[model samples]
Target: MRTLGLTRTSPVTFEEAERVVDEDGHGDAEENPDGLARVYVSPEVDGWTLVIGPWCDPCDGERAPEILRLCTELSVRYGRAQAYYYGWQGDGSAWLVVERGAVLRRYCETGEAEDEFFALGDPLPLERDRREQLRLSLAAEGSGDAEFEDEWKWAAFDLAPEIAEALGVNPLALTAETRVRGTGVLAVTPHRT
Candidate 1:
């Protein structure tokens, strides 16, 4: 998927989510049904509210900071917020975990050696585990930076979904059995173009 925000403390209502998205006061959150540059806020799916759509994708390098600000804002109100990104056509991944307006951890690896627009925080537990596992397996077979890079890179690709599933919800695995609380809604993100 592109990118989305998930929070444990969902806003009490769809209106609340819309309000967060309509910060610029465009009044476009009034159910326009246009589907252009809108943010789709899930209705407490698996106890987490997910914010998704064009205006929230931090994968766009130029908009990373602004998108992160938006996610942090959500966390401030909701207690905790997470943003995840996976490129649609290539090998790329990123994730940010925020709690109460503070960035707990952020990681972005898109094969670019110099991209730090989103990378932050120490490696999460799962990341550390994978690194150790790969190290052991590689050591047994004799490894180089290329092999290490190949295996380690896969860790980034798997992180967003793996961490989501382990910590709370996995967007890619949501299904009818996912125990949704209410129907989701689509609203225009505040910074929508």
Candidate 2:
């Protein structure tokens, strides 16, 4: 796994990362004392995980473009890379797998993969209905907070087939063999096989 342009200083415990994220509202946006970007490590189903920019605010509408630009820059620097952005609001999110600065696959709500949710050829109407049902279910279950809502949105990329299926997206299509590149900005362990 590559660091993806992030600077890894001292190791941080998941508890500490969670605390900082809880206080600051973002894990990847902050800089360390040396003025380098900080990457947080947390536990994941596969193994430990490292992630940046799970930004969850609808107010940050400008962030999408910035994230895209950053993705482009990172792809240029790293050769091949994948980027995913989730929008908490109705705008939906985008997933891009790029290689050598060219996008191998681009998936989004309004793109070629639009109907490829949870299942290939899932009708748009059905997808919308299922998403609405999920939203309502989350609301009723008292998981309507911004954080959980953000989690719900990002569940589309879950490595688990059953989880992605529950979210109305095909697990096989969602899988990617992404190599870690760049500095220390990105890396997932144990790396997805």
Candidate 2 local lDDT, 1-193, one digit each (tens): 2433334344455456545544333333344322123335333313213353344111133444444554456568766444444433434545554445555444443222322331212223333455575653423322446564444445443322332233333313323443323232232222111
Write model 1 residue lDDT over 97-181, tens digit each, in one string. Answer: 8889988778776777644545676667777777787663434222345666666776666567787787678877877787778
Candidate 2 wrongly placed segments (more than 4 Å): 1-10, 26-49, 55-60, 85-93, 106-193
TM-score for each prediction? 0.69, 0.36
Predict model 2's lDDT versus the native.
0.38
Residue pairs clashing, model 1: none
Candidate whose lDDT is highest: 1
Model 1 Cα displacement at 117 (Å)? 4.4
Model 1 residue runs over 4 Å out of place are 1-36, 136-150
